[model samples]
Each structure stands twice: as C-alpha cells, then as structure tokens.
Target: MDLDKVSFNGQIVDMTEDEDTMAVEAHVRALVLLEDALKKKEWLLLDREIEYEKSQELDPNCPFLHQQLVLNLFHKLQEVQLLKNGDSAGKTYVYPNPDSVNIFLGQSFWESKEYLEQWSRPGTLILAASQILGYRNVAGTLTASDIYAAFETWMNHNGIYKNGIYTCCGEALRDSVCKESSMSHSLLPYMNEFDETDLKKATLDILWDCQKKCLLVEHIEKPQALLAIPEFPIITTSLVQELIEKLKQVKFKCDTRADKIAYTDPRTRNIIYVGNHFWKQKDYLSCGSRLGTIILYVAQLLEHPHLFDGATKDITSETTVEHQGSNSPRSFQEPLNESIHNHDRDPPLPLKNSTPSNIGDALFNKSKSETYGKCKHTADTICAAFEKWMSHKGSYENESYTCCMETARHSVCNKSVMRSCLSELESRLKDFV
Candidate 1:
C-alpha cells in the first residue's frame, strides 16, 4: 500500500475478493468510507454495523471491528479533525477545532476580497473564532441567559420614554403579549405552581414567543426620526467609538448608534427607541451584552452544550477504543492517551522514517528533529514556508499571523500546519535531496 496512492483511491475495494481476502478487504472498505465521510463533513452515522457484515461473512476468525473512531486516525491519515461527538448526553456536540478555523479563514479569502468582510454578516464563523481565541474581552462560555441579557441591554440603552417610563417597540409588543399570555387574561395562569418538567416546558414556550414578538416589533415600524424626537440627544464619546471598534473586531456588529436616537423596524416601521448609554457602564457585562449574542451564536453553530465552558477532553487515537463487556452500552469513553495528550503542546512527533540526520536534514526536511534546532537560519526556512502557505491562502499581511498559529496548534500533527510546513520544506528539499 503506497501512501502516495492513498490520495486518490476513492473506490479501492473490490467485491470479487475471496473469503481469504475478505477481512483485509473489509478493513480497506471501512477506511475508504471513513475518508469519504470526512471529506463530505458528515461526522455522524459512520458507525453503522452493516458495513462490517461482509468481513464477518468472509472470515469467522476476523477480529471485531471497533465501532468507535478516534482522533488518532486524523493524525495518521493527515486530515484535520474539525468536530467530535459521542452517544452520551451532553457529550454529543460539535466543538470548534483548529481545522475548522482554517477552513473558515480559507473561506473568508474565497468569499470576499476583504477578509474582514467575514464580519460583515451576523453569525459568521469569524465571530466564533474570535471568542474561541479570546481576542474579545468576553471571559466565559456563552449562554441563552447571556443572549436574553444582551437583548435587554440593547433595549434599555435605546428605549424611548413615554410619561417618564422607558419603552420601545419591543416593550410595547412584549407588554401586550405578556398581558395576553395568561389564559384568563390575567397573570394568574403563569403564576401557578408547576412541576419541574412542566415549568421548563412553559418557560421555553414563553421565551420562544417573546423572541418572535421582539422580532415582530423590530419589523413593525421605522423608528421616529432622531431629529424630530426632542427626548433623545446626540451622544458624543470616544468610548462609543471604541465599543464599535471592539464589536467589529470580534464580528459582533450590534445595532448600537450614537447619532441616531431611534431606529425604525425595517419591516413594520415600528419605532424602537434604544438609547446609546450601554457603553457608559464599563464592565465585562457591558462587553458581554454587546457580544453575548455572537458568543451564543458560535456555541449554537458548533452544537456545544457548555456555552461558557472549555472543551471536555482531547480526542486521540490511543483513547478511541472501547472495552468489551463494559457497563456503559450507549456510549464509550476510552482512557486518555497520556502520551499524545501530554505531547499536544509540543511540536509534532517524529515519524520513524523521517528523523533528520544533520543540519542538512533539518534544513531540507523540516522534520521534528529540527524543531529543537536553535539557529536563526533554520527558523528562517520555517517562517518562509509559513509565509508561503499564508500567501497561497491569500493572507498577504501579518494581521492573521496569530490566527494561523492558533489554527496550527489546535490541529492534530498530520492535519496541522506543521504537516503543511514540513511538506513545503520537503518540496524545497527535493532539488537539494
């Protein structure tokens, strides 16, 4: 099996193989299917037992194929592992990974002339990347409550006053809805005690309705003209500008404006009064209020349950296998592969055949042996390779230098920028070799 041919053998399994060759054939088929699945970004539904039936038919002595897939296969096969999930509750989620970041960066380059345009729309991957990278001042995992608070903050800062009481189009609609929410036209129905499940269901229903109504008010009417409204004064502050810049940097372009007193709901022309005082309170909550939606959007996009938490664990090959006769049948969790886990922060591990022999090997191959090489000249070569990859990806400026590094560090060795960098070095070494 030539590693080079592994690149293009999409349909390598032959159906005519005899029983003696069936086990090997089955293994090949599984690998091929798995690779194909990854290319399509379909992570789930790969563990179907039907795929293994052919091998069992051919060789009764064949070992039972593992149902679980490990992240190690990513390193061995040289593919980025973008997401991970299991059959366990709260465990099955797609979290951000380095490979996914690269794909997004690459996409930004492909989709827009200005990479920053990745932030032009709501819920872009760039927003998620910023949160994951801790570029924004946001300090914790995002949550639904955070999103609700953000909406409220936006409202409080922008609300118009009617008889000294702050109100906006959203509030008007919300008040009406809340009043009607009671089945008997009173709050009595909602005020009643209920079991945990029933209360949770009721709460979710109300929240969902509130969100729709908020959207409705926003759509109902254009905000009254700022010039015509005597109650609102034009705000002037550098902090507001700074806030906008921060939000833009993190890709959370909230609808906060200083020049405008109120904004019109694009759909219904309902005037929504949102003041510009949210920036007055200088705290993390202010930042969270501004960017909280983006953070939650990121979490939802990745299907991560812990909006404000870090990843559960690194998925590696050593810990991919499950023990037989275990009490846990619905899901499997292998022991952590200490070697791989510990070495994650280190440079890529050396392959048995690719150890560098000297400075020449280090220079030409850019193998792991050269990772410890303490010379500026070797460092120059690696930097040059990195620049080339960035150029190929249309990143001509150093603005994305940290982003690239973060993506590389998060990826498995084979699927990482280290591999790309090494491959770049090997190509350069071809003439020298």
Candidate 2:
C-alpha cells in the first residue's frame, strides 16, 4: 500500500523489444479471433459466447478480448457515423453533438484518416467494436431504405414476441423504440419495440462509435495535409502549430496521425466513457469530452432489459456487499467509521479501504462533528490530503512534459526539462502531515 511505490509492479516490458514478444503474440491472436467472428457476422454471438458465465463480465472485465471487439465494431460502424446526415437515416450514425462547430470538426477528423485501415488487417481492429453499429454490405449497394426496412421488420418481430412485457405503463414501450429509431437493419433480431432504456443504450453505443470514428479520419490526414483539404483550407497555421506543441508538452505521441484530431464534448449529454487508452476517447479526461463520454458508455451499457429489472439490481447490490461490506477502511479511518455507523439506515453502504492513508482518510465524514475542534480537525485533514493528491497529480504531469523537434526552428521547447519538480512537490506535501 505504499503510495510512493506506485510504479507498475514488476519489470516494465519493452513492447518493441524481442524479449517481450509475448505481448505482441497475444495481440495478434486476439485480432485474429475477432476478425474471424466479424467476417462471419458473429458479433452478438461473440457476446453470448463469452468466457464468463455472467453478463457483467464484459468490457474491462473481459480484458483479453474487449479492445479488439470495440475496435472491430468501430470499423464496421464507420459508414454510418462518418457520412453526412441525409436520407442516410439509420444507415449512418450521427455525431451526438448538436453543436454545429463540434460536428464540423468531428467530420473533418473522420475524413482525415482512412478509417478503412482500421479493419483492413487480418483481423478486426485491435480495440474497437460493439460500441459502433450499422455495417451492412448488402450487394455493395445497400441504400438507406433497405437498412431501415430491415430494422423495422426486426422491430415488429421482437415486439410480437415481447408484447407481454408491457404493463399499463411499461406497455407503452413498444411505441417508444419505433419513434426514436430512424432507419436501419435491426442488428438485434428480436428487438421490435425497445423500451426507453433500450433505445438509450443503443444511442450511447452509436455516439461512442461516432467519437472513435471521428478521430480516425482526422488523424489520418497529416496536420499540414489537412490544411489543404477542401473543407479545412483556411485553418490557421498558428492554431495547428499550437495544438502540436500542447500534445508534445505531455509526451503524447500519436501512433496514428488520425489520433491527433482533438475530441471535444461540451457536456450536451450527461454521459462519460471508460476504457483503456487504446479504446478511450482522445485525451479523454481533461479533453472537452470529459465525464460525458464515460457516462454515456456506462449508461448505455446498462440499458439492457435485465439491467432495469429487479434481478440485476439485486445482483449488483449483492456484489457491492461482497466487495465493500462493513469490514473496510472505516475500521481504521475514524471519521469514516463514525459516519458509516451513524448514517441513516436506508440502503446498506460499503467502505473502500484499498487506498493509502492520504487519500483513504478524505472519504471520512465531517458533517457530524459536534465541536469546533473536531470539525476543524476533520476539515484540516481532508483539505491537507486533497492538496497532497493535487501536488502528486501535478508533479506526474510536469514530469510527463516533452519537447517538440521543429525541423525548421532548431530549438528545444520543453524536452524532459526535469527539474526537482516532483521532489519539491513531495517535500511540500510532507510538511502538511
């Protein structure tokens, strides 16, 4: 539990080095398995045919296969999300962004990188499926109408079978799915009338696909080359130059040029995204996309019918109990102990203890302190710990800075100018204790 020893456990494997060739082999195997499934149109089947018995064991929990699935899905969904909005209807996914500026930039990025490269390999893209939809290669000339008609028929099929699901209130669900769905082939055959939750989940996946695809097109175009594209001709060189500098300041090297196009979510949708760096949104956290994408991802993932039913809720509650019951950090963190013990008896709450004292204590309760001394003590401790956390985050970021090499300007800007910034920051934190 040592905080200072947070470096990755064990020796770091140099991926490019011959010694760590296993990692390379693993990735290749995964991509191969994924391609076999997609080329055969076995997406949902792959979901059902999983390693784990439980459904929750998807996404990150299914680490070995998740990224490849997501990537492949994104590649399949490209035709829908990347094209201009039109009679395309359900044939394409629209960027969730309502803001015109965001849409334009997103479209520019999609056209930048040849998104086709993502799926041109022996297997699916390494890390992008499931979230994207609408990959129909019907006669190499599938129109929007064909896709929508197929989707509508699928909806009716599911509605006929699931008709009993409607109570007086929930019964109205059939009409809902039909309303939101534009037009497309129903990927899920038994889904004639999706409830509100179902539609939301589908929407989330579509939006996630949009963001991933947006990066593909832009990053494909070299920054200089993009300026010459018919649409982005007058893009100020200064802005592009500054953007490049910012990326270097953080040591972010885009393996693919399309990854350079920035994604900005102005929080129009209260969704947030969660995934590995490879599957995550570009510059995910601090980037304009922020919590919205993560929320979107989780919320959508949670939209299945079982998720809303009592069965899933009870399971989640049980899991929470097993993972974070009473024997937790509250046993050691005094303030947290009192807070938990005194909390109103409503839903059972678990405690998290697998954290260092600096962060773990911050979760304690200060609201119930009866005296000024107790209140001040708890307040001070929380404030001090927060300051320490901030310093650590700042130092890590400072150490991350890199310098950009300008071929014309022969000068170093911020190349690993490691001062004692981290050490100095740590020293300041120690005094707080």
Candidate 3:
C-alpha cells in the first residue's frame, strides 16, 4: 500500500514518519470527517455500526474517537426517524438531551489533560463562570450533574418563565430594579445597631450631604431649612453655634472662647431657654432630637474648612482699617470684654497700632521672632502660607504648601498665629450664623 496516498472517506491521507504522530493525526482526521458527515446530513450514506467497530479497532484508547462514533450513531438514528415520518416529524423534532450531552462531553473532553490544565487556577475563573453560569457546589472536580444544576439555577435567577420558555431579563435592568427595590425608608432605626465604624460612615455620609447642599455654614435657624431626611430632626441656631464652637476646639485644637462656659453653669440656663424657643414652634425637646443634624453640619464645616474661604475674604474686605502713614490695613484690636458683650453691632475692623486679640490682628500684625524661631521659613512667609492654607481646599499633608514649605499641623506658628486665625474664623462664623 502507498501510505502517503491512502484514501479514507473519499479524502487522501498523508502518513507521517513518526508512528505515534501518524496514529494521533489519523484519529483526529476520522473524528473531523465524522463531524463533517453529520453536518452535511450524510447519515444515510454512512454505516453507523460499521464505523463504530472500525473506530474501536483502530484506537480503543482514544476517547475522542469513541465519542465521535457515538454522536454519529445518535444523529443517524434521528435521521432514520425523521425520514420514516417525513415532513411532519421535522415539525416535532426534539433537541439532543442536554444532560446526556453534558455527561458525554465531560467524560470525553473535560476529563482530558488539556482541559484539566485550563482549570488549574480555578478561583477567579470559577467565580467569573459562576456569575454567568450559576454557582457550583464543588470546586475540585466538576461533574455533568453539577453543570446541569448550575445552568438550571442560572436560568431561574436571570429569566422569567413565560409560555413554556425562559425569557432573560438582562443584567442591567435587573440591577437597577434591585437597587430601586432595596432602598430603606429611614436610617434612624438602625442608628442604635451601628458600631463605631458604622457610626463614623453614617456621620461622614451626612456631612457629605450637608456639604453638597451648602447647609454646613454657621447659621441654620430653622429645622425646615436643613436637609429634609426623616432620620434627622430640626435644630435651633444657638445649639448649632454651640456645636460649631465645640467642634472648633476639638477639630482645630484652637482656643475656646473665654465667654463659653460649661453646660452646667448657671449662665447656660438662659442660653438653653433661648435655643429651646427657636425650635419650640416645630417640636418640643426630646431625646436625640435634632442631635444628629447638629453633629452632621458641624462635622461638615470642620471637615471642609475651605467652605469659609470666600466668606473670609468678604469679612477681611469689610473689616479692613488703613493707617495714616501706610496704605496697608493695620492689625485689628478688639478688647475681649467688648467682643463678648457686643452682639448688636458689626465686628470691629483691624486698626493700626492696636493690640492683637482676634484673627484680624494675628494676620496683619507681624509675629515676634521668638514666637516662630523654630520655623524654617520667615514669619511673613509663614503668615502668608497660613492665609493661603485657609483658602486652600486640597489635602493638608506636610510639604504640600509651597509658600511655608510645611503644613500647619507641623508648623510652630500653629501655636500662636495659626491657632488664633482658626479661632477667629470660628468666632466670625458664629456671629454670621
């Protein structure tokens, strides 16, 4: 026999020099020819039993050869049935049993070393498959039954059954519908259940909302003016200002107002009564009433001090006091006693040659060398950077500011001038709010 010119299924076959390579190639060609015969509907011309016997005799160890023969036999049987019943049978034709096909394919293809190698790193691959193919109960060795179960679950989860068929609702619409349906009516009920981390997240969320709404400023006289979430109650302006003061001391580590006495002081009773009247028209004082709102708005201002940048400029322009000898505004000088008592008039402006007490003075008045001796930059540069930092909204990391070459947190000037500037800003915000 001429091995190079041997013919099988009407196609010429070329045999290679290596015996093992020739055998494998011959088996692969036979499988491909069988698939081509099935696709071309040449079942009547092919003898199923004879072909199966031939494949077995040729390569009994080749699972693919046996699988192809079995599939060819199945198609032949279906063709026989169809021809016997004519056109009517074609209308009622049934698909191959998926479970049976799965079992056959798993045994013949998936069990092969090539396919097994694909799943060697199965964690991410299996997870991605499960998202589209449904969850697998076992990860080690997947069976035909496991695949069938996964398909069934995936169909059920992603499709609606109608007219004896499953119609898939795509992932996008499903996600949007799920989001819309899952929204909670109120977060207040869960407040008590929140741990420290959860409370922090909730507080941050509320502060972010306030920041967006521009409600974190000094004044919020009416509860109705705040964000209208049912979970948060209305608050009085006095309580809002009080919370701002407390937060200033806590957040900025600035000096507290001299007049700000403790809650237990006899002086606080009148202040409490005045604050109560502000919210009494809306609702009476109760436990946790408007407390959450108070914390939220206060946190927003403390967390985002840059919100006051525009207002700071406006305050500076309105309070600028020029000296006779120079065009520049002098340091503001307001006695602590007068500032504490004066509530009806506009805040005093910076005056030349006056003693420094508030933020205005700290900004215009030059700091002594002793006060800022540890600083690498000059006093003027530090003061300029401090003003720039007030207007700056970005992160406050060390070496972030180009002017001072250091951050306020690390600067020695933070003790005197920086501290006073923060305190003055808070005081000014309180006057306006």
lDDT of each: 0.23, 0.23, 0.24
Off by over 4 Å in 1: 1-95, 98-108, 113-269, 274-433
Error of 2 at 20 (Å): 42
lDDT of 1 by residue, 1-433 (tens): 5321232233222222332243233224323433432332221112333443443332222222222331223232233212211112211111123222221111221222211111211112222222222221222322212211211121111334365343432233211111111111110111122422332233233223223222111110212221222221111122123223332322111124222211112111111122243223212111112112222222222221221121111112212011001111111111111111121111111212111234342322223223322321222222222222211222224432233332221111122343444344335445443
Q: What is the C-alpha RMSD, rounded to one decimal, of candidate 3?
A: 32.7
Candidate 2: where are CA atoms >4 Å away? 1-52, 55-65, 77-81, 86-433
What is the TM-score of each predicted model, taking all chains together? Answer: 0.14, 0.15, 0.15
Candidate 2 lDDT trough over 10 residues, lowest sum:
321-330
Q: Model 1 has how many clashing residue pairs?
A: 18
What candidate 3 gets wrong by more than 4 Å, as runs, is 1-140, 155-394, 397-433
Best by lDDT: 3
Candidate 3 lDDT, tens digit per residue, 1-433? 4321131122322222442343243233323333433442221122233443343232221111123332533343223211011211111111222211110011111112221111211111111222122212222222222222211221112234455443332222211111000010000011122332343343334334323333222332332322222111112233334444643332111112111111111111111111221122111111121223223224323221112211111112212111000112112211111111112211112112212233222212232112222112222221222232222223345555443343432222223333344354445445545
Per-residue error (Å), model 3, residue 215 = 18
lDDT of 2 by residue, 1-433 (tens): 3211122232222223531243234234334433433343432223332443332222211111223443433344332211122221111122221121111011122222211121211112121122113222222222122222212221111222155543312333222222111111111122123332333343234233323322111122122222222221111123223323322222111122122211111111211211123233222211212122222123222220111111111111212111000111111101111111121112111211222333322222222112111221221222121122111222223334123322211111222111132233335445545
